[model samples]
Target: MQEIKATMAGSVWKILFKEGEQVGANEDVVILESMKMEIPIATEKAGTVKEIKVAEGDFVNEGDVIVVVA
Candidate 1:
């Protein structure tokens, strides 16, 4: 399993994949809003999305796990 973590503190703006969906390496899984900028968080591995750890509008800190892929 691989954990996709938030790269910076922000509010989750969108979730790009659903649980059990197949994802490619470096695919954007979530979009986060901070300081009026949108930052896309991507997975480093190609795998099925096993979990979504945050919802839209949820606040997250840097290093927080946002999704799990396996």
Candidate 2:
């Protein structure tokens, strides 16, 4: 299992994958808007996305869980 964390405080801009979607290592899974920029969050390991903890335009803190892969 793996936890995909946010690198900065931001709003979730987009979710590129859905629950149960397969993801590759280093694949971009989420996009966040912070500091007036779109930052992509990449997966560290290949796995199915088990859960998404935030919605579009939802605010998140640095190091917050954005997705769970397993």
Candidate 3:
């Protein structure tokens, strides 16, 4: 399993994949909004999305797990 973590403190703005969906390496899985900028978070490897640890409008800190792929 691989954990896709947030790169910076922000509010979750969007989720690009659903649980159990297949994802490619470096695919953007989530988008976060911080300081009025959108930041996309991507998975480092190809895998099935096992979990989404956050929801739109949720606040997260840097390094917080946002998605899990396996």
Candidate 4:
């Protein structure tokens, strides 16, 4: 299993992948907004999306889990 974590503190702007969806390595799955900038979060491992831990507009701190892949 692999955990996709936020690289910076920000509000979740969008979720691009759904649970049970297959994702490739380095695919962007979530977009976050902070300091008027958009940050895209990508998975480091190829796998199915098992869970999404954050929702759109949700605030997350750096290192917070955003999604899980397994």
Candidate 5:
């Protein structure tokens, strides 16, 4: 399993995919809201989304695991 982490402190803005969904390398999975900016988070490797660790509107700190891929 691989964890996808938040790059910065922020609230989860949106989730583009769901658990068990297929994802491609560098595909945008989540968008975060920080400092009024939208930051799109992508998977580093292609895999199935095993779980979403965070939900939309939830706050997360930098390096917090947001999703699990496998």
Candidate 6:
């Protein structure tokens, strides 16, 4: 299992993938907004999305767990 975390404090603007969705390595999983810029979060490995810890429009802090893949 692998945990994906927010790299910076931001609002979760969109969730690109959902639980049980298959994702490839380096595929973007979420999009966040910070400093008026869009930031995309990507997966480090190919796997199924096991959990999504943050929802769209939710504010997240740096290092907050955003998704779990296994």
* Candidate 6 runs further than 4 Å off: none
CA error at residue 3 for candidate 5, angstroms: 0.5
lDDT of 4: 0.97
Worst 10 residues of 1 by lDDT: 42-51
**Candidate 6, run of 10 with poorest lDDT:** 12-21
Instruction: Give the per-residue lDDT digits (tens) of candidate 1, residues 1-70.
Output: 9999999999999999999999999999999999999999998989999999999999999999999999
State the local distance difference test value for candidate 2: 0.97
Model 5, 14-47: lDDT tens per residue?
9999999999999999999999999999999999
The TM-score between candidate 6 and the true structure equals 0.98
- Deviation from native of the Cα of residue 17 in model 5, angstroms: 0.6
Candidate 3 — what's its lDDT?
Answer: 0.96
* Pairs in steric clash, model 1: none
The clash numbers for all candidates, in the given order, read 0, 0, 0, 0, 0, 0
CA deviation > 4 Å runs, candidate 5: none
Better of 2 and 3 by TM-score: 3
For each candidate, the alpha-carbon lDDT, in order, equals 0.96, 0.97, 0.96, 0.97, 0.96, 0.97
Superior candidate under TM-score, 3 versus 4: 3
